[model samples]
Target: MFLTRAPFRALSRQFQQSVRCLCDKKDKDVKTTVWPPENKEKRLEDWKVIDSTELKPPPAENPITRTHRILKDDILRLKKYIPGLDGRTTRQNATMWKHTLFGEGEGFPEEEFFPSHCDIVIIGGGAIGSSIAYYLKERAREGLRVVVLEQDKTYEKASTTLSVGGLRQQFSLEENILMSLYASDFLRNIKHYLGDHVNVNFVPHGYLFLATEEGAEQLTQNSTLQNRLGAKNILLTPKKLKDRFPWLNVNDIALGCFGLEKEGWFDPWSLLMGFKHKAQSLGAEYIDGEAVNFEFEQNEHIQIQGVPSGEYNSTNNLIVKLNTGEVKRITFATCIVAAGAWSGHLAKLLKIGSGPGILSVPLPVEPRKRYVYTIKSQGQNQPLFNSPLTIDPKSTTYFRCDGLGGNFLCGRSPSLEDEPSTENLDVDYSYFDEMIWPHLAHRVPAFENAKVCSAWSGYYEFNTFDENGIVGLHPYYHNIYFATGFSGHGIQQSPAVGRAISEMILHGEFTTLDLSRLGFDRLMVAEPMLEQNIV
Candidate 1:
């Protein structure tokens, strides 16, 4: 019921009252750290006890509203005060909180016309692009200019919006683990970076990766790597896992690596917006359009557009063609292709990286489809599922409770085939019945008869070459850079990648973390930095 289309405005209003009451209390000795309870005589102080009839209006009982009311009452009872607050201040806070949940009801105004020239232009306006923009603004010298080109301003098909929003340091590669650690730290102190006006509701409950006998060795190895890279993860035996989470069926599990802290899910779209808004505040411009073609200046069969100190060359300039039939030629000092799933096509348009032919050295990123499902069990058991986000390595199936007790959200690994187009957002019903449900039911027993509520699909900027992120400048094109090929782990790693790219642009190398391990040169040298934990 919590995830349904039903509006939570009433609950939101009541919660606002509770927050105001907490803030307005004048008692210095009052304990504000705890949430107060309501209806103590009926033992409804926790607010978890509710029947179906309580959710309807009039007789529509507004269960969430009741929950908040009881919570406020408990707080007042604890403080030995009346349960009320200043009405005006309460209304103001309520309005602000409501704005945070549902936006201010404003539309994204179109960028009327394309710019003739700019210092730097970034393709794509998703999380990565926004992060780059924010970081560049934060690091650039005065008079620095930046523009972002986004085909879809609504972000309906953006991978960041479609992501499951999972953040973890259970990666096999050290760089990957480090990036996640950076992300966790950034997320924990997000208010300091993005301002107090924004919050992504990051819940660091943790992640549990289960491995059967066949994959135990690799899982163990990954756990060791993660721990060596300063991650707080521990390898759990079947007995330990069962002792911790009795809801999970660990009968066939050989090993499980559980993150003790600094890992979990959050609202990715909010984070993206925070980046975009902050970047805009710093004078970075975002335009709604698509990049179609690129024109390069050459002399004596030598590509000179991106080369800074080449001998056989001319003045470096490029004409970028947009889908709106307008082409602008400018000598940009640097350009970054931060496009996610469509990075390959953008690279093909430039044809500057390494491969067989000029066209062969594309970014190697493709659009791969992944599905997510939401379901709820009919069982009336109290807190039917209480565990970390669990993953089945053998089946590549992972799931977690969706904050509504019996309701759960689940997904599996990427499909074997690549999607023909990046625009496809349709979910396949058969995949659940045939693939995900069986594995989930087997692992949790309680999910055997779960009712499938809804499903959706999104594209991953899958890397055909190494499946790891590419985070540095191009090998051949000196000034051209890339921050793509994250396969499926871009949202959590965006902050680190953005900071690395910004450092590269400013100082010609990464200063904070050496992300050179994910450089384009690796692909050229036939040495891929293979990562074991992809899910």
Candidate 2:
């Protein structure tokens, strides 16, 4: 019965094809054509109907189309073995299209399935972590898989969002100076890297660091170093400072280091979003979860310099707790601890500080709460629109104009003895009135009558050792790396730090900047990369 039905099925299909052709011909014949009678060949060619069974040579495939076909075939093959692979790929493609057609929306739809494994896993999804993801995926494209685990998607307490968005190249250390210079370049040409729709709202007024008579020599030396390293800045006398900024009171000031170019503040939130959107568009997966713990495997084959012969344990899996309260494990070949202020705590999960030998040295990064207050000084002698972000070395107070209104943002990092509790993000208005107002009013007499309008507090990924970023592999776990301990300059240095981390991961060494001095090895050697300009 099957053999008899085979020929009948073929004949039925042929009959249907013939009927379809006839109906199509009749429909075409009834439609009126605008072509002249002389263009008979063109009309026939335009309305030609080929046979269903006829074989025609395929058209030439462009590079883009060929690449897409290869990717589609690979996805199709993997879909059978990998659950939800096809759906994830489709959603990612849709997200790319959405971002390209209409600028970034709320975000890509929340992913339903968490990835079981990835090539690289970043602990934080703030500016630093997102920037690292962006650089890695951008360089490796589909060849690399990067997953960023962020505890909070809203970024309410993220330091990158709450920062004052200051960018300056005035630093005593060469590494910090170079990083700031590169950040300025990166932000200036941000449209080339992160789509044209992304705007940071950069305000290029520059930074002014005031110094007392006791700190004048150190300030001059810093200014000299900054100028020698391609930073456009000038060492201004108190008379020159008063001339440039009429609102400033330079009575107690001995010297002022003023940035002439490539220094300013931009919208940190926008910059963070740009990095995140660009990273996601480049195939980086951002998981909404916190890294609760780490799982280690005892590997007999692996050996470290200081670790005992048989006691070496390798860590490649992270236990994460999702926002929905589901705990899962994600295995990765490499892990980067860019968790900002929380990096030290995350490191402790892996026995970084508790373990014997080199692991006993803890990651000194921790959250230091600093308050920022916005004040309005409406009366006479208000700071001009172009007033630089001014810092007083004596009191550690800094203030910068906030847009066109008669408003300014001022803050002072509390002394170590007077450090506030990091239990919450509550703003202490009294700290600003007592510690900050006295310094700000003394620096700029216009702020003497300023009334506090609003206040906020954020964590500075403070490094207790030297207050500088630690960017390198861990001493014990070769697979783990760190890009934390940036003190208060992480956001501005994120672009350079991300590229540096990617370089080290992909190329196995520092490529662009020789940040060897700023590595975890420094902690082991008891040598700190101290920067004279901490603010």
Candidate 3:
């Protein structure tokens, strides 16, 4: 079978060409000579013709019109859930609902209409109050009606807006530490909870606490506890302190505790607005008004062991005075007092201190005016951009870089005997010159040339009793709860406090953080959950 190479190759090529020619002839015959040859033209035309109708694009839809259509459809779908809704009023109600959710045109009121009754009434529409509203509505959605009453919508004197917006986990108490930890996490993932458009502008700068020999032991203890509870901080000696912060005067400093992470400052106003907008979007109502008084009724059926059978006053209605000089009463199933500095006053309206037994103890939360001064230092070897929100524990003076422009914010809490008047939010510039400047100059010699560019004052919801937040239900009133008395930490702890309040209301217990020790029950027992690291 082995033929010569050239002859074999020539023969194989001839055979392959003959097979390919036969296959091509068979395919041509099958393609041209189908069973129904008469309809060949129709079959060929069908293959060639494309349906232009199917290829045509759909008409463009206006975004506004599409939004209206979607809203209308949603209204119709939700109409069934509303009992006693008739066909005649469906369109009108739907239009109102659309305007309420989306936007208001002329003749449509921008203010939230007063409701006669709601599930919960929150007194004070600051960051803490708004947060409670947000968390409640977020959990219950339309199933819950939450109303927040604020005296000032502008928030000119609001403690939340006026705060320096510092967030740190350096604390002596476990509750405060845990709350701050959650706050850092909440602010970090704020977009997931509040919306993608919301930003808190969190600046991740650590807080440096400088302690004298007298306070060195306490500082070390606090640092140890803070680190044990997932907080990252380091204790540095005098030499290390000077090395880390060369501009700092550590000649008298015995120890220094510096936070490594989850400690910083943010825009308090932004956070407050974020809570407010999200809460409103989730069906919480914010009314521009002041909580003037409470209407209480004695319930004979309900009895408490400490109170007489018929003397138990149950608070279910709140009288609010609107910004327009109109007063209205709102009945609520449960009420929360988060009035910040004014919480103590609101508690008085409920006869908290005037009443008998457990109500004798007031909220102990009052307004303590604190001043913040912004200074600019152009001296040589001034604190750099990396400088933290530094604190001198002995002097109770603290300062932090305001921006990259060599501006710094400095303040000090007044001595107990030298507390200033809180009649107005007036900043006393003399305070900085007499009380704060000397300490600042000593801490950083370069601060001697710093000039006060501006200054402002804010009221701390100072808890006179323990200087801690008064949370949970009041012993006298079963339906009343408190999320106030945070002193100066309310802005940072608003998220955790709101969630804790919501958990208490919705689940009848704290499901996440056990803040029982911070409850009003502690006030009755006269045990204060005091935190040593207070600025």
Residue by residue across 156-273, what tens digits does model 3's lDDT show? 8899999999999999999999999999999999999987768889989899998889999999999999999999999999999888888999989899999999998999998988
Give the per-residue lDDT of model 1 (tens digit) for 196-225: 878998877789999889889998898888
Off by over 4 Å in 3: 1-112
lDDT of 2 by residue, 300-367 (tens): 88888877677799987677766665556676789999999888888888788889898899999888
* Candidate 2: regions farther than 4 A off: 1-96, 99-108
Of the candidates shown, which would achieve the greatest lDDT relative to the real structure? Answer: 3
Error of 1 at 45 (Å): 59
Model 1 poorest ten-residue lDDT run: 1-10
User: lDDT of each structure?
Assistant: 0.71, 0.79, 0.80
Task: List the RMSD of every prediction in angstroms.
Answer: 19.6, 18.8, 26.3
Model 1 regions more than 4 Å off: 1-113, 299-331, 353-360, 379-386, 414-423
Candidates 2 and 3 compared: the better one by lDDT is 3
How many collisions per candidate? 6, 0, 0
Better of 1 and 3 by TM-score: 3
State residue 335's C-alpha deviation in candidate 3, in Å: 0.5
Candidate 1 Cα lDDT to native: 0.71
